[model samples]
Target chain A: MATSRGGAIGPALVLHLAVLAIVVVSEIIGLIRVPIGIGAVILLPILYAFALGIIFNPNVLKATGRVLNHDATKLAGTMITIAIMPFIARFGTTVGPQIEKIIAAGPALILQELGNLGTILIAFPVAVFLLRMGREAIGASYSIDREPNLALIADKYGLNSPEGAGAMGVYATGTLIGTFVFALMPPLVHGLGIFDVRALAMSCGVGSGSMLAACTGGLVAAVPDQKDLILALAAASNILTYATGLYAGLFLALPLTEWLYRTCAPADRASTMH
Target chain B: MNNEIAISDAPAEGRAIDLASHAVQLLVVCAVALVGNWVATNVSPLEALPGMACLYAMTIVGLVIAKYMPFYLPSVAWISLVAIIATIPGVPGAAFVNEAVGKLNFLAMATPALAYAGLALTKNEFAIARKSGWKIVIVAICVMFGTYIGSVVIADLVLRITG
Candidate 1:
């Protein structure tokens, strides 16, 4: 059961426009401060992460509607996360590089496998767990059979059904894993004498874009319900994590994590759709 | 009964544009920008602060324009114009172009990787065999090895070419 299509288009257009405006304005402001630029990039995925939490959560829009209590808590948790992330990143960088040099057999092939595992273990799970806890604390709920109206919209666009949403979730998980792994590259590269901040930023952007595109595509195909909202929120978080990882991996962690997932586990991908 | 249930479940068909929502979004963007700028100042010593007055003016004007027009095209057009006017020869548009390209590149890489992963998950291929955790670990180790070797190969190629 869908409403007449007339009203939906305008609101969707407005939301899209709003997103564009935010990106444009933030990028412009970013030009003045390099850290701001880094922040802008990092913020995208963080925002996307939160949006995914909302989209997947059965009670999100309703919770978001109750701005005073539920929504406020979620927002507060997000802000707290954001506030501490930079410090965490700083610490990670300081500790990572020194450990890299000591453990590596030689300075040249300094990509430490353990570093990658640590990133996967530390970053993705922490971010996802925080998001899930925040959403739950904010009273967001989910169930196997209770599909919201937004899911219908997603279905109409040929996205994942409720049964298929897990596929996209896995993709998000993978991206997070990949991002943490790539985080070590900046330091590893620098240890080899390629320590240019701008260049590092560019490389990070490439890695982030790749992850975002992969995640977006999967979500669009399998979990289109509130894809726009999810993307917007997740993008914000992604930007922050990427920036922190960049600073941490390059400056602090020398022979950073050397993990990569070139091909997906066939069983995990297949089991995702209903 | 069915009709009523369907009708009630849906959000209002045509509630007027939520100006409040738009306003909230704008406020969030501005707040994030301000905080981000403050953080950047502490982190990057070489950065030049964009004039707050100019930034506010630009953002407000941008918001106003967005109300009546499409968001991305106009904003990009305006930002590009500002950048062009601000650019000086030999200064290089590296920052602007690099930032833009970097965003584009992230999206590009993310799509395929996510798709593959999604497909794998859906197919139930993402399993570690019993007593085979070590095998999975080995694969992960190999991935690390591959990335390092790959980077080294590329770096060597670049150095040779440059020399």
Candidate 2:
């Protein structure tokens, strides 16, 4: 039975503790010189896949259903606006010549710096407003309660489901697929030589982010109640793994992959693709 | 007295959930995207682009989960944020976001708004599922992993053949 009590620690807290423990242990292990170069790149997708698998499992969905049902249309509109905002901001800038100079001086360096700043200038407020609007819309439709509708959704998606073949199997499969696709692009790009290894890596990495976002969104919608918690966990894990993976990809994976792609990819295949 | 109590309390409860969810969702989404962006940077050579891509991808994934599965936006956002933050850092800076200010900027300024917008635009839930489904997620993951493994294997093979 649920009680009306404040500061009550529950199973979720326990789980959070366990996850924290794992993170600490992993970091310690990482410090032991595990040849992080290659391992780091490979680890990102694997870890992310696993985390998301857990978070978006069925149990989470059951919880969300009990709390609320959001308006689908408003949510969709918000996503489109958010997606387009970056491009609009970038191209829409009035400082054309100054931007060109920065771009010309060092495309990657300048863009990286600008992008970071730009994301700040434009992205945050928009998201907050959208969320606020979404909640308002949801409120109009459903009764308010402490138990979040969002959490209920997490429960229903099998995110907190018992570990089984279905959850683990699917997650593993997805991770493998993501990793493989990421692995292939560098070589193909390297063969072209039109862009540096770093440039190719950047393109591929960005592409992966875009693809992952779309793919994750689709997965969340499709699985619904079967893997809510698993999905949530996996999503959480991806954030951690991807953080390292992104760095590794930028510094290590891209160069190594490019070298490999240039040397190993069949001359004919590389040539044909280029 | 009773009527006055009822009127005042009524609106508070009604608005409370909206306020709570909105606050939590905004914080969680922004935080996750910020952390995810940091992680993606570490994994790929692309620096910020990969991080951004991963953030976008996770957002999409979270949306999918929320739309179809029974998960809430806040929980998904938090879980995603924490997980990505945990896994991506091989070298502190490599996988992690460089400069606290940068991290703060992304989390504070960019993520919430974008997430809100993304969530808003999503529609045709049934169509999205029918069109993409589990197969697409599976395929996408496979392709990602395959590319990495294939690149390495092919590279090794080419070296051997040439030698």
Top TM-score hit: 1
| TM-scores for the candidates | 0.31, 0.27
Per-residue lDDT tens digits for candidate 1, residues A1-274, read: 1222222444333332333333333333322211322121122232332234334222334442332232222232222212222212111211122232222212221222113223333332232233222111100111100112223223332223322232123222332244434333333443455432212222221123333333333333222354333233223223333323333333332222111111211222222111
Q: Rate the local accuracy (lDDT) of all candidates.
A: 0.28, 0.29
CA RMSD (A), model 1: 17.7
The digit string of per-residue lDDT tens for model 2 on B43-156 reads 222334444443444444443443443432332333243324333335344334222222222211222232232222212322222333454343333334333333233323
Once all C-alphas are superposed, what RMSD does model 2 give against the true structure?
20.7
What does the i-RMS of model 1 come to?
Answer: 16.0
lDDT of 2 at B1: 9
Residue B163's lDDT within candidate 1 is 33
- lDDT for each residue of candidate 1 in B27-116, tens digit (9 for 90 to 100): 443334333433323322123123322333333343344345532222212322232232222335534432322222122212112211
